[model samples]
Target: MNGNRFGRLFQVTTYGESHGEAMGVTVSGCPAGLELSEEDIQGDLDRRKPGQSMITTSRGEPDEVTINSGVQDGYTTGTPIGMVIQNKDARSGKYEPYVTAPRPSHGDFTYSAKFGTRNWGGGGRSSARETVNWVAAGAIAKKILATQDIEVKAHVNQIGDIEAPEVTWEEILEHSEENEVRCAHPETAEEMRDRIDEYQKEGDSIGGSIYFEARGVPRGLGAPRFDSFSARLGQAMMSVPAATSFEFGLGKEARQWTGKDRNEDWEFDENGDPTPVGNKHGGIQGGITTGQPIYGEVTLHAPTSIPKKQTTVDWETGEEKEIQVVGRHDPVLPPRGVPVVESMLQLTILDYMLLAGRINPDRLDGQVGEYQTDYHPRSPDNMKE
Candidate 1:
């Protein structure tokens, strides 16, 4: 309950249950005068919504977003931007069986133990549905970042044991959405789709990883140590439901690398600014941005809810029971998670940029290279009477 909010200057607070009335979020600290509308957010929501394809859950929720406040005449008012997405297809009846028995590897048991009682309907706040609010807030951040030419994107790179080859940024932006798997590589996406189909037919689930990147992020946008850029990004990626692992450049593979082999030498850019010769550090060094493309991967565990029978104890009856988690569920997650990962990256980058004073917090004055001086107050002597 207390941990629903995220970010420092640009904060987002979310509310609602998976099977309750609707999911909502209030985004604070956004500058006034930026163009915004429900349509701007609905696109990202549509990607994360259930019932997208054969690999995803069949629930028919539209995930349409409605901006309830903080805008006037198609622009933000710099207040808390309130948005909501109603749960049109939530079926709580299917979850009733696990109310007491709990689902394996699901949050039902832990939530009950922590809160003493829980909504127990579609796992309540523990459901992946809560991310709808995040994607909505992230859309605003994406728009804000876009004003500065910052772009964030992600692709499903690994599904179960199948992995896609390295792809260019243009390929990621182009072909990632062309298939059901959201993988940039077309052939690999087909294989991933078939693998998901196999799992769906078996009533099982599989895990996968998403590769995310942020370009045009300015340097000096992060503090050191606890507030490092990578630290905040790791927290953001790990916060996604079902996310099991997170890694950046070299990441786990760095263990096998020698310091000399892994180190990136620096040189002067054409602008006479220092630049790393290579990006083995993943656009960050000493916990701060390096003016390179920030890239990483987030690995999500398989969805726990499946029709395959699993055993658990019924706390209410104090007896064991066999449960088939019969309900609409995604056999794999990375396809739907592509947008979520991109959103988290956008939110994190925007927050850091705001914190570093790279962007004007009150409003964009519609001028290039005037962010710091446009709205500044004049001296008392210079003020008109």
Candidate 2:
């Protein structure tokens, strides 16, 4: 895809269809030798994998990742890294109903309009299955960012009408993984699960909010104007399939505040660094990091293809009909989306870090050895306007 390539540095180009042979990524400009392992990538993949919760699709796939190049003897070689994630849970038969009738709020119609044909099976590239590559690349980006002491974490903040309490970092880290909903607040997670269960019984799906934070990121990440880091982050986040809306910091809530309230009061730390009394800027100001925790939230729509019947039109017959989609789908996806959101942020962070000289020499200290590394391009740039 023309828009698949991302980054000014540490660029990642994702490829493959959702139900294609396999989906994978080609990462250019990653500093080699920062302790590479399948577990590092798999840890995140397992979370993003389906069949994890009562609320998610029942399709069983481990979403295992296999690294093919750019590392040797257990360290990076400062070369491009490539990895592949096989798709095993695809049920092409389930999509037969949609062959002639495009599902609403999905890419089927747009893809067919764009290409004259679409992969009706498993939502094609628009499927959340595509994010397996994003998570894998983010795992690699985490390795690249070890030097800056930067950390990115995300959790579900809301599901349907269930909302989480304002949570502390300690609580978020402790409780996010404690439940299938991945809500940072203990009580809210329970409520989210209950709501999802209720929706499942109705043969439907629900959407929710996923919030994220990046701490200790040095100042100056995103560029301003055309290259504003915030703008880039917004674009990158919105690229995730099924992503409905995204906001930085106070986000939509900021619009309700006047300039006097919207402004973050400044403070001087003992280290003499600029600090804001509140994170109204989401740790970013003037399109650069502000030495505060970078924060944002992603809003996702409920998955399409619910078992319950919905109305649609047949493209060939021009006759509207009722359709009950039969296929595996996550009844609640925001909780599982936590890693994908974090991955997008991580990829952006490392990319800008590379351009900013934070990851220069294209190498992390002690990560380079005599091991040979490999690099290959996924495809030529589309260059389509």
Candidate 3:
């Protein structure tokens, strides 16, 4: 319960369970007077909602988000924003059989061991259902970043062994949603879809990676050491269900290169601004944005609730048994995870921008920027006023 919160200035605390009555998020530190509505948040929710495509879980939840508070007359009030999505199609009965034998590669056993109890229905807090809140909060963060011309995008880069070809930002924006797999390449998207269908027939699941890019990010947005932007992004990605690994910019590939090949040389642009000749660092250096596109990838593990029987120990009887997981689950994760990844990046970047004081709080109220003419240092008396 204590670890439900995320971020420093722009914070989000998610609550509820997979089969619980409702799942929701409380977003705090959002600037006041920004335009907001249920529609703005619902658009992203619809993409992440279950049953939208054949490749995803068959559970038919509308996943409609309702704004409970924090906005008045279509604008934010700078208070904690509360939103909820009722779980309509949660089938708890299907999971009754697994109450004794915990599923392999799931949070059931560990959660029960840590908390002395667990929600057997749909893996409770461990379910990908928890990401609903994150997407909702991220939608709002996206709106905040839009004020500064920052945009975050993600696409399915690979599914099992099927990998998508290199795609540009425009291609990702224009074509990612054309298919269920969310790959930018049309042929690759179809192949990924066929692969998912093939695995779904065998009652199996597959995992893949997602590529994330943040464009138009200004410089000076990250702190040093502990709260580095990359560290925050990694922590956010790791918190998602089934997310196994994260790497940004040549990540593991950098291991093969020497220091000279790894270092990106700097040059002056036509505008007299310093720019990197090559973006080997993925647009980040010394824990701050480098005015280049920030890019990364998140690798997800295969969903554990396959239909085939698996060996496990019964928690109550202390006996070994084979259990066939029942109920609907995703055959692949990257497509749905694309929006989730983009949202987490938006949240982290917006929070860092706030902490860095790059964007003025009053900007939310239609004011562009606050300027000062005096250069005199502030004394304790001036600060008090």
Q: Please report the candidate that would top lDDT against the real structure.
A: 1
For model 3, how does the per-residue alpha-carbon lDDT over 112-151 read when each residue is reduced to its tens digit? Answer: 8888888889989888899999999999999999989999
* Cα error, candidate 3, residue 346 (Å): 0.3
Model 3 residue runs over 4 Å out of place are: 366-385
**Local distance difference test values of all predictions, in order:** 0.90, 0.82, 0.88
Per-residue lDDT over 202-315 for candidate 1, one digit per residue giving the tens place of the 0 to 100 score: 889999999998899998888889999999999999999999899988889999999999998889999999899999889989999999999989999999999998899999
TM-score of 2: 0.92
Runs of candidate 1 with Cα error greater than 4 angstroms are 366-385
lDDT-best of 2 and 3: 3
Q: Measured by C-alpha RMSD in angstroms, how accurate is candidate 3?
A: 5.9
Clashing pairs in 1: none
RMSD of each: 4.3, 6.8, 5.9
TM-scores of the candidates in the order shown: 0.95, 0.92, 0.94
Better of 1 and 3 by lDDT: 1
